[model samples]
Target: MHTTEHHWITTPITADILRGALDLEHTEHGVLPHRLPARARAQCVDGQLAMAESQPSGVRLVFRTRATAVELDTLPTKRVYVGVPPRPEGVYDLLVDGRPAGRAGVTGGNTLTIDLTTGTAEHQAGPVGTLRFTDLPDSVKNVEIWLPHNETTELVALRTDAPIEPAPDGDRKVWLHHGSSISHGSDAASPTATWPALAATLGGVALINLGLGGSALLDPFTARAMRDTPADLISLKVGINLVNADLMRLRAFTPAVHGFLDTIREGHPAAPLLVVSPILCPIHEDTPGPGAFDLGALSTGKLRFRATGDPAERAAGKLTLNVIQEELARIVEQRADEDPNLHYLDGRELYGQADSAELPLPDQLHPDAATHRRIGERFAELAFTADGPFTDRSA
Candidate 1:
């Protein structure tokens, strides 16, 4: 039951160095570049700049997508989540679907609340933050938000009840995705240029980017999050972080993945869910991880030191990429019967090779901007089209 709503048309606004408070957020918003680069000096270092000269709260909306694309449905009920950057006290109004959703601000901590049931205003309170609404009308093709007061607020994540609509006719199938920093586009050159963003363009499906930089360690919170959300297609890019971050050992990895899949199945028992492992990394491929740096990488002064992963870490069943892949094969094979819709995408196929031409990870990890695009393209080819995203989903 949705009524005619005012569709907010988005205007191209270049990110700016404002005259207000600056709040670093999980997602990039109100900035020149859409993503925060890994090295801090990359091209898309939008959020790296200092806050506005003025003390006013500089705001940015941290929605999951740079722009939210919703298809015209009989009844569009979408719930978008924008991560709240740690903020101070202030009452900010929120206008969604061209109505007064209400003002939500932080009195102390970092969260704000807006009640759309109250008033009707064309403009909402500034201090960009996360908010949710329901019963979006089919005619409301686009949703434009206004943060009049703050220079910018981080729009972290976004979601919808209906699938993302394709452009022109706006009737494409919904595409849902989940992954780690690579998927989150942590150090990409630009927001729209992230691997997921690029893949979305190639596939023409609505995107649900669940890439939480350092937080994609296959936790219950994440699995629960996925289960709660709806998607026509789903993909989970796991591994690496577990090894890189040294989050767990081989003994724990298999069971943890089983638990993760089990959790998602609670909600999406029938939808296709793809499980992807990490790509090739010289430091952690067949070799084991929880790697240590080379002692020689350290400067005598000790002010700056670089370390390489210990070669010995890959002895047998340590934390290497090969070991994880084997475990994944086992997990997927065992679960395939219970969950016929389940699938597995080997990360190596995305970037592995007999030649093994390694891309130098500036920090001994994570891909550079160019590599990110390459990964995205490879992913799009394998995941999207064919029978589905990751057409080559097998052992």
Candidate 2:
């Protein structure tokens, strides 16, 4: 806490200062970052969509300030699944001069409890919480506060001992990426450790992450949002959500993929557009889904997912992880004839059977922290290096 003699300067949270978010909504308390814009959000009225969009997965506060201490006030909506172990508290990562400085978390926020069996959700109101970072070197430096990736956060106010300005843009390419919850940081230990975030850091790119949990269903509105957003590079990780949600058949999925890419092409016709298939999820690798929580694991205070659909259903056009990978590869090949910039990277290339053998997904779905680091490192080497699909055209 700063002494009274230290006059706090409050800075308004504006678009120019926010990074890795596509849209910002004015809330009663303050501004809420949305991975999908208002127009896109309006197109979907489901609870999953609501929760996913509101949670600012890769959103962060970026600025340059001379403050020795900083305080951010926020209202967060935390999710609670009924009959399961309580969720971990969200972490706020602070980076000074582009180096990891410290990590913190807030307490006492609104809780949304969802009953999986009944498909009912109840909201319990809570008070706004403050995250304070102090005892820093008193000099002008770039500062970044990566918001909690899993919680829906309303940025109420930011106060610093010194005046703050937007961080100057670097010579990095702007990489816009979209995917499901796994890409949304699922089990990644911290905000900055998410695969996409880690990849961006290694690739030296500015990330606009549009990864939405349980909601990457090839929605046209999401496609439209990506179509309109500006980016130097783009990538889409598809399939897992489609399978887990049991949202579509392969017959419908192929056309949806084409349509989504079609929309993105409307804006960036020649940008490197890499399409990634799902990572290895043994449960969904051969079996179809509607993924269900593992009751046995749940009873033991663990959260694990199991494919509920029969493996035989794949013959009926029901999509499985393996099926999606094949379809996606074919789809990308067909499109690549006309769109030379289009490329495909099988998710297995990032995390396959062998990698799984060594670093198993704790939940039999999303990767753990170490796997995230591995994927990010591999992605950088595969996609961002020379002769990679995402190699710079100008070079």
Candidate 3:
């Protein structure tokens, strides 16, 4: 009996073949893509920001190949809650010629266990794992391997049955968006299924998603990173993280919003800049936060969040989603007179009271997979369609 021997070609992971990441760090085991630059990362000591920026929400490997089979070796850092059931393995989505073709999950990788009660984390090292995709067409096609939106993945190597080259630029407008955990794909089905990724597809634009879970606190470093990054269109989904983290009071929040927008305009003066308020979050709509996890839910093998602060605190300058939306609207309106390119979108327009009634947030904070699709569709219609803020006037 004769057996076929396949020749596999290995390619080193590099920035040229990557999209959505701002920087690539060469680690001892592999290359890690970062949403924030080294300088910005150095300015902050928050572990949440460090972890979130490294998760690669919208990052992907894009190349042109006719390979019948492909394998990517990676070291993924999976998260584990101390008391709750272990979460499922992260998914890696594959796209062929700009359409979903396959999905895969790796078995072995490192783990970061967290004790929510103490806000502590412990890291455990593990072996590298490989994701494999086979049975491709013989004709040349553009292939994209979207990294897990919620996992910190260090890409080790790419192996294929046939040689691959970096995909040629499609010349689509680049949309740079920054938001909270919801946008980071907390409950998203897969990396490519995140709202930003879906919206980007429908809008026919390239996406640079800076959706950092638990860390979108309007940090100046984040703003600076966005200022430096090249993009044709820009947006910020603020308020949710700020209110939940109890990061700032009303006084500081106003200036922070202005400063964040100022920094972005410094780099993209004429680019359409859209400021989006938080979607309708009943828990934080009238109440303030420091949001907390519901301990009782842990016993039921379900993790849930609850707003912990008092609504009366609003008298003392504490913020709620309602207050935030009003301030954001006023800020945008005040600036629009001087900056015609600037625009504002009340996020309730994407997911509001009516939509929430149909698809409630399972965790009471982040949206479920179905809600992500709804929000993405609404955003595409509102921002990418005719007479929208992101409408291509040049066309």
Q: Give lDDT tens digits, candidate 3, residues 1-395.
A: 97445589999899999999999999999899999999999999889989999998999999999998999999999999988888878999999999899999987899999988788999999999999998878889999999999999999999998999999877899999999998898899999889999999999999999999998898999999999999999999999999999989999999999999999998899899999999988999999999989888876777999999999999999999999999999999999999999999999999999988999998899998899999999999999998998989887
Q: Candidate 1's residue-wise lDDT over 1-395, tens digit each?
A: 96645344333332222111122223333332212222322322222122211111212232222233322111111111122122223334333432444444331122224222232213233333444444445443434232322222333333454433222314555555656666766446544456776686677655556564544577665677577765667889887777766767777777889898888888888777888888776667755545453333322211111223554765544576777888887889898987888888888777676414656565555676787788888878877767764443452
What TM-score would every model get versus the actual structure? 0.56, 0.97, 0.98
Judged by whole-model lDDT over C-alpha atoms, candidate 2 comes out at: 0.91
In the range 284-353, model 2's lDDT, one tens digit per residue, is 9999999998888777767788889999998999999999999999999998899999999999999998
- In Å, residue 353's CA in model 1 sits off its true spot by 3.0
Top TM-score: which candidate number? 3
C-alpha lDDT score of every prediction, in listed order = 0.51, 0.91, 0.93
lDDT of 3 at 328: 96
Ranking by TM-score: 3, 2, 1
TM-score winner, 1 or 3: 3
Q: Best-fitting candidate, measured by lDDT? A: 3
> Lowest summed-lDDT stretch of 10 residues in model 2?
1-10
**154: Cα error in model 3, Å:** 0.5
Over 4 Å off, model 2: 1-5
> Of the candidates numbered 1 and 2, which has the greater lDDT value?
2
